[model samples]
Target: MSGSQALKADALDFAGDTATYALSLFVIGASLRTRALASLIKGASLAAIAIAVLGMTVLRVMNGAPPEAATMGVVGFLALSANVASVLILLRWRDGDSNVRSVWLCSRNDAIGNVGVIVAGGVVALTGTAWPDLLVAALLAGLFLKSASAITLQALRELNTTGASHATPVESSS
Candidate 1:
């Protein structure tokens, strides 16, 4: 309810992260190929979100008011704090296969995105314009797209190397 497009974008990123974790759970007992496929799906989903956020940013730029700066600042700081904690916790496992690495990337993204949100909030507070908010949102979308591309490329590489032996492996432990 802050009217901040930046915060809205961050919220979407958090939602995407949650979904990624859910997908991770589904592949916990699966093999490399299955995990890679899950990562690919997650990456594709993130790409879709980025495109949608960009479209939203464009519309907001055309006709949007400044958000509540105070609210944005407070929430952004809180988000950043939480994300940083997650980042620290996930740092050790950041370098792994596509699926495992995607987890760390998504967690890292929240902290980086929050910094932008906080900066946008301060700029909006000073200028009383939504331009900063919209800009940050768009930039976050670009970040999302970049992360998605990384995940997708790594996943494709893993799939290629693993061959077509288990393209559609069942995830059941038994």
Candidate 2:
């Protein structure tokens, strides 16, 4: 396994992506308000992940250990491929509301993060320093935080504009 903090951050973000995507799926046919609420939740979770990544990145910087370059390159490439495929598929829906946009942004961010990891691996191999890896992790954390803000803002706007009550309905199962 790669000792890359950037890779760990990527994995953490991907885990958040998986959970949010599942939530998105559940609300696909829901009302606009519901979708907006879901998007807000997703945004909050993304922000949480970003904070977590920052904490780890600081620890990695203090540790100052270079990752395994070979492993980082291979894994980053594979992750990039998968995320790029997702980005292509989600391109058309990227213009939609926060619920839809969140998915697109997450995929795009994944690809970007993967690229950073790959570059960091190369830099670490060349310089034999942990700076590149730690820097990439910090940058990825910032990316996540930015995306979180965007998603949350759009979701709030959608929630305000949607013609519905703010309170979510409680489903009754007979």
In TM-score terms, candidate 1 sits at 0.92
For candidate 2, write residues 79-156 as lDDT tens digits.
999999999999999999899999999999999999999999999899999889999999999999999999999999
**TM-score attained by model 2:** 0.92
lDDT of each: 0.92, 0.93
**Backbone clash tally (model 1):** 0
Between which residue pairs do clashes occur in model 2?
Answer: none
Off by over 4 Å in 2: 163-174
> Over the stretch 25-122, how does candidate 1's per-residue lDDT look in tens digits?
88967988899999999999899989989988888887888999999999999999999999999899898888889999999989999999999999
Off by over 4 Å in 1: 164-174
What's each prediction's TM-score?
0.92, 0.92
